[model samples]
Target: MTALVEVVRSGFVESVHHGSLVVTTPDGAVRASIGDVHSPVYPRSSNKPLQALAMLRSGLEVADDDLALVCASHNGEPDHVERALALLERAGLTEDDLHCPPDRPRHEPAAEPRRAAMNCSGKHAGMLATCVAAGWPTADYTDPGHPLQRAIADTVSEMIGEPIAWTGVDGCGAPLLAYSLTGLARAFGRLAAGTGTPRRIADAMRAHPWLVAGTGREDTVLMEAVPGLLMKGGAEGVHAFALSDGTAVAFKIADGNARAREPILVETLRLLGETPKDEAREAVDRMAVGAGVVTGAGRDVGSLRVTGAVAEALGTGS
Candidate 1:
């Protein structure tokens, strides 16, 4: 790993975040890299878009906005929960069929925990819908040996152009597959530029960015601010996205610090000439101002900024 971002307080470097990052050209060739882009890592919820594509391939049918929710790591707001329940109702199922663990809304700490309010519930609902559509058993949809999971595994391997390096259980209790960051970037690039299946997933996400995340979220804010940009972030500091031109970026912060993610992503996009323009520019600027800043005594005192190897690889140093 290499120093991907640094925490600066009063002009002094207080700490550093080590990580790996890879940028791919429109055709999926590595344009720049830092740290171990080739190593396999569980991409967690970042894999939702790919998993949603797999469900679609298996005959899961839903409205575009619902499909966007299928690719979400949502904030579990009322709209998100309602859409999730609606998908289950349409499939002749209910929240009881959802396999993801019950949890409170990410955006509402005071709310009660419910399966439908779990961030991964939308995905679980989609999985059940696919099973219903395909005439597969829904009871064990989350099992690795289930038809839906096998299909998802195959889809992931095919899209990433790499075999699964490992299989593990995700926080949502679904089967998780691992692949290199380079392969992950390639998959997103394909989703950005390809037609048919990949295009459908990308279009749904771009059309309903709010469902994919929520108010004030980095994924929602950035995707809303940048036209044709598809972004997703996972647990453990993983983030990936692709531009309209098919250029893609993927990275993982070694220490799993979420605070460093946005600054690094914003800097990476800026370095690659993908900065938002016109009206959207102001939205992105506002979002950036809230990222990575440190506060003390209720005042701004420091910030986490992209620096070292990743910055240098992108033709900047800080």
Candidate 2:
């Protein structure tokens, strides 16, 4: 099948393999994508919202404002650092309590704080707090069977409306469930418009868009522009979103190229009726279509497309 979906190039091709996705409200489903959306690829930080669901289940009762940090993949700007610290303090914990790796800030070139954008940091912090409230052990908080993570997996499964078929270690050392792209999309859609856990989590992300990503982040900007949108992006060319109405989208770049993010994201937004066709095109244009790092000298990689059973799933009501 000539896998390793390379974006065509002039006299050469580069490997950029990664998954992508889009999901919409009322059902959380797949509208479009490439590669194996059904594969249980590690969702990375995109799964933060699901993790937040567990904190609530654990009786943390975090204010709506703090919900942003709980569900963010922040840039680790000062504000993000301060908020994360506050979250830890709120739980009667401290920076020493954080279990994620230490790293430079995620927002960058702006004297960003350390590891704040490690999106999982806030989630981890929240979990630690939950443990504190429950008096559980903190040393292995990242373990899948840990009370917090155990609850997180249950919540994730319920949101996706299915049992996880497989599991993997995420970049942040948490359990990553193997989920279908359509299922992942539908899970977000539920957050955007479904009842119970879905709507509760979606509301938190929308109400605190800043906490979902960071200042000037495309996901943050997109949510703000679209209003009440459900969106999240994973590392390695993975993205997903849910419209307030019934729309879901997902994509995986055969080769993981950051340059492919905008076009694919905008395209998915357009498909969900969240963006004007031209606006989508412009967004993709900003991705430097033929830039040296992307496609070679003069070749245009094709736009993202979605197909297969997942298409039928999204089309059912998306």
Candidate 3:
């Protein structure tokens, strides 16, 4: 296990986060790693791009921005909802065809719940479009035995280079596939370097970072700051990213706090001798790490930071 992050309070060590991470080349060779990288884990929504590939294979077609939405876990801002609805319209479907439950927009915290505002709505819309294009049934498209799901399973198996060890329901009620962290890294490497569908998906993500996430969100902000990075984070502490040079990293935090992701991402890039641009660095800096200012009553009382092996890897000594 790797000591990935620490919570510091009033000059005392409070808690620590442990996890595993792996970096790979475009060819899927391991470049660097910490902790166990072969254990099967659910990557959650991080696998959206690959799912979009399955949809494409089923004859779903749309503009790049819409395609990007199909690969998004967006903030459900106005544009996101609009595009999702538009995708459904293209298929002669509607919000009623979506299986993802209603939810308030993540970007607009105060907004009311809406089916189209769910982060996974765009993905469901894509699946519906695929069903329409392939002459399949829309109502049960989320079923594991549905043709769409079978095709998705095949696509995931091919990309990860292994049969899935588990199948579970995702937060959005869609199938969730499990793969080893290294396998996830390898798939992301291919997305970054391969031609055809993989390249097209990556291009769409890079070209429309906002659709991929939203304004000021980590994924959108990071992609905007760094010209050619394709990044996506998943629920329960999973993150995957690839650089244009074909270097990729994937990790999971033992504790499900997403705050631990970016520090390791930046550190991994640094370890690979790739420095983020100044603006990108600043964006990452503003993110809430596991360790940082601890305040009570609006006054700074202490701080937290990365410590232990991962911190050492980041070249920040404890």
Candidate 4:
């Protein structure tokens, strides 16, 4: 089945979000999907955790607390910035070692007063620290063929149970690879199952959640919602999540509607027997309706309509 998120504003499709998804339990059972679960796709920010796991094995001296930051797509808040800065300090390095170009903070409007918290900063800082620890040159750190990049690429390949056959540049100028949604889900399953997730990787994320995402971000919220659950969302309507109990889900919006993400996300979670609390459900509901524009100027307008054979399997739609 396929779907597109419609912008009620102009009743037009601003983006295309067509892709498959796979829901699997830690025990390795396939649960449900809406499209081609085995279709290859880029992992995006969702790959951070895998990169961090490789860093652990590469002999990087990052503490568990710092490991979390390494795997995070932070909100670039003051504290998030401070931690990223501190990571640089700890490695006796600085941002110059980072090859990722700077950009505007991911969260604006409310946090407009402070501009330091760009989502990629923490990841960049972690990359810089790794370069320092490895005694590798910081120049061209973003090079796809760089030693660090190679290590991460290999790590990602190993996690997915398939060799990466292609590469592309990411929004932050790092190497990006394609993999089937099942491959992505399997990777998360490995992490959640702690099969391939290094101690450093898990400890870092579990110990310092805030560094993973400042005060409140979806990554933080999901992790908080399901304690010990490692979650990450990528740009272009992609999200990856793993329950410590062994369930994992990977999805992409065929039409890249960030709004559709909420219901799909909650729906996926609910399939895993997770029923969000009133507050959490409400929060997800808001995103479902284009960020709090739910309920007809005051009604519950949040929803998703799963159709076709895939929907037949799931048994529901908007």
Please count the clashing residue pairs in each candidate, in the order shown. 0, 28, 3, 16
lDDT of each: 0.89, 0.65, 0.84, 0.69
| Per-residue lDDT over 1-318 for candidate 1, one digit per residue giving the tens place of the 0 to 100 score | 689788878778888889999999888899999989998999999999999999999999898999999999999999999999999999999898888888999878888889999999889999999999999999988899999999999999998888999999999999999999998999999998889988999999999999999987889988987788999999999999999889999999998888888887788788777767676776666445333377787787877777757667876664
TM-score of each: 0.96, 0.79, 0.93, 0.83
Query: Between candidates 3 and 4, which one is better according to lDDT?
Result: 3
Candidate 4 structure quality by residue, lDDT tens digits, 248-294: 88888765556556555655665556655566666654554455433
Per-residue C-alpha lDDT of model 3 across residues 1-318, encoded as one tens digit per residue: 778777667777777779888878788888777789888999998999989989998899989999999999988999999999999998999898899999999767888888899999989999999999999998899999999999999998898788888999999999999989898888888888879998899999999999998986778877887778898889999999998877888999988887667666666655556666785676666553423446778776655465556545444453
* Top candidate when judged by lDDT against the true structure: 1
As for model 4, its CA RMSD to the true structure in angstroms is 3.9
Candidate 4 TM-score to native:
0.83
Predicted structure 3, TM vs. truth? 0.93
Query: Judged by lDDT relative to the true structure, which candidate is superior, 1 or 4?
Result: 1
Task: Quote the lDDT for 29 in model 1.
Answer: 93
Worst 10 residues of 1 by lDDT: 283-292
Cα misplacement distance, residue 277 of candidate 4 (Å): 5.5
Candidate 2 per-residue C-alpha lDDT over 206-283 given as tens digits, one digit per residue, 9 for 90 to 100: 888877778657677677767667788877666677777746665555555655666456545555556533544444
